[model samples]
Target: MTSATETETETETATDAASRPAPPLIYDGHCHVASTDFIPRQFMEDVAATVHRALEAQGAAPPLARLVDAYAAQHQDHDADALVAEMDAAGVARSVLMVPDFSLRMDCPLTPEEMARRHHEIRLRHPGRFWVFIGADPRHGADGIAAFEHAVTQYGFEGLKLYPPCGYSPSDERLFPYYEICAERGLPVFVHTGPTVRSLDYEPAHPMLIDRAAREFPGVEFILGHGAVTYFDVCADLALHRPNVHLDLGGFAGAALPDGWPTHLNRAFRLGLNHKMIFGTDWPLNRMTGGLTRLVREVTEGTEVFAGVRRREQALILSGNLARLLTRKGNE
Candidate 1:
């Protein structure tokens, strides 16, 4: 029943849409290879128990064992096939996949070395889709340092993943040797910078704890994971003062922050922290919140999140900064 003029207009609009340019590709600054064996069983149990208790309170309870099994099943992507599909759909050009060392704090099936190997294999399979970071607790002493060096020199890992909540401060002297290796290789270090699950020691992971290390290792870039979620004000302050410090928006989508993600991001932009901000979805961690596609669209599709942020600054956050940081190391 449409008139010829209206039908013609519809066709013209479709053509215009098709002709529009694609958005710039993104480089996820923080992510993980979601394999249950790589993670601590106690941590998963704690998460499932919390969910089970909440469901029970709501009279929608499933058995605890079933809930735990379901949770474990959700993170069984030992291979990067599913991750690459999600990345392609989300237009993510690459992701930095990190393995957190929990051997000292919890019971994990694979040691840090084994976990690194698994990630290296996945990277080999995916070609240009991933950059791997090996986790090593300095408490492991000489053996740990050797394993980390081997991962970097032999396995092609590019960065260091520090889980401060695993009961160590970022500035702990024991980590100096590891920092020395990273500095020599021009690799960046990603430190968990906010509260984590109750099973871990959250106090040791404060953003301020990284200040000393940032000062000590001026050449090594320090990225505060979950920086845009909790303790954002402190994280922003640190990034503003320290040239070596940066922030990653990994848990921004899922964390129940005070003013929400867009507001927090806009505030950071207002404070001129846009250039130091890095895009990250934390992958399977935030999949419940519409996955990577939704996170990308939130920053790129509209002017809401980037209203005050200029296009160039937005690019810096989405991929430019991470590219410059990682590629600089690779080139050297």
Candidate 2:
């Protein structure tokens, strides 16, 4: 019943739509793209070879060499274009790039000025695909405040990345000014919570520390990274009760999934704490494919009636929640 001109138009529209890329499943909320100095070349090579062998051992088809080469590029140095290509291969759309500490001590080797420059360049390169988090060392005193301001004002970072108990403590009143500035700008602060190789004491891993900060800075949105690991229940409680608190399953959830991990995830979900969860892989520290596969399997296996809930929740935690949180006040 259609005319020849109408048929031709419809065909062109269908072809155009089909040419679009598939929507990404993963949006890594937290990751680090740092100088290779923090990670030796040999160590990265070993990890790549390990991934290669693991895939081969499973009888999985060999991945494209271009994919492997792109991922390996992340190891040598920070390249925004290479990272974007790797993300595409990994089915990740966006990643929040954070500075890395050589010793996992929260003290960065790069000066604030250098960090600002790099942040600007990365934003220029990737645009919406990459977001910046400013690293602040309270030990720098007034200089630290200046650096933080520069990162926000000049570099246009949306959040602050802190490793409390590594460089300072949540209870330290000296860091109040930094917190105040974040609250004023409505910047989110993601604090590293969970066991860290750098921590000699366990106090830093406690969820209670974040609880206090949430109470003190009601204006600032606080993200407790790694979900306080051994203190997941406590973190969940805080997230459920506090108006300004959320948690990210970065390394903790992935590391916990192999044995009886579904039980913990189910418990967290049943507690009505699903809205507070976000996805992260602690890149250069964890692999995206492995982490995502584990999450999908564990969540899907954990429920029967909630199968749809599981899928929706995974999508929310993996990307939607992050999009909402990051774009709360036009930071998107």
Candidate 3:
């Protein structure tokens, strides 16, 4: 048996050891609170099925039923206060939220104004902990552009998020005017670059399309969402070639880190582009402790892919670099 003083000392020693190599200050660069009303039910179903299969294939316990339950819960709640509380618990200093463009396609009944309003409310409620980006669909044509302007100017939204899976290329004429709006306003755009679930036009989601737009509108900054995962080679090429493009690590650690993540990241870091990256938990979609916590552990200790990276470099990946790029004295 140990005395109370000894127990206290031992606990303090453990705490000190844990604090020695602390995780970086995180600014979660992508978080979505897809409305319980609008986001596709099918999307959740597909996700549950995919993870269930992945678990069974790996012989993981119980075949992802708990994951399915979590997905169901995520789809039903658009609660901002809860999200902020979760952020506090997870040690995330701030999170950037975005309204997605899937509403029109999935037959969800809501207008751009409604979505923007909801996201803006979250921002208002948790001012420092949250910032928001509104989505614009070029297919809605001039009406879409009008709504996007309203979102930025009316709601004080800081950015735009586009889904190419909605069937418009970055270079399409329909989207050019929206890009112009972003350029003149100095707002960064987060464009989805990976394969979409049951996508309508896969080619439009290609990362190369962004290269064209980046060249054409040099004033506008673009963020390649998911970092184009499998198409990372082209994505890296774009980042290397263009000063206006950046990548966010939102979906890469999808449903658990897929094999080769370290290799993919190693190549990117080797190419000397770590500063162009941002950390995003892709929260709710990814549970904080399981995914984000695991990532912090793997990367900090140097996995096969992240071997021997310095602490400051890992800090940069986690949030420091993102702070420099985002709005309103973020780097400070």
Q: Taking the candidates one at a time, how many backbone clashes does each contain?
A: 0, 0, 0
Q: How would the candidate models be sorted by lDDT, starting from the highest?
A: 1, 3, 2
Candidate 1 local lDDT, 11-92, one digit each (tens): 9999999999768869998888777878787888888888898899999999999988888888888897888888998899
Predicted structure 1: lDDT: 0.86
Worst 10 residues of 1 by lDDT: 323-332
lDDT of 2 by residue, 1-332 (tens): 99999999999999999997555367787877644533334434444565677688888836646445655565664665555765765667788887532234434445556766876787887777888877776777797788788788887888888766455676467677878988888788888776654223457657677777789889888888888345777888889899889888676454555445455555555666667887776765644455444443444334631344556776677688788778877787
What's the TM-score of every candidate structure?
0.92, 0.73, 0.82
Which ten residues in a row are the worst by lDDT in model 2?
Answer: 100-109
Off by over 4 Å in 3: 1-23, 49-70, 255-263, 288-291, 300-306, 328-332
Output the TM-score of candidate 1: 0.92
Query: What lDDT tens digits, residue by residue, belong to model 3 across residues 107-215?
Result: 6556667878877777777777877778888888778899999888888777888988877787777888888888887788899887767634678888998887899
Per-model C-alpha RMSD: 3.0, 7.0, 4.6
Candidate whose TM-score is highest? 1
- Model 1 spans with C-alpha error above 4 angstroms: 1-21
lDDT of 2 at 277: 81
How much is the lDDT of residue 120 in candidate 3?
A: 76
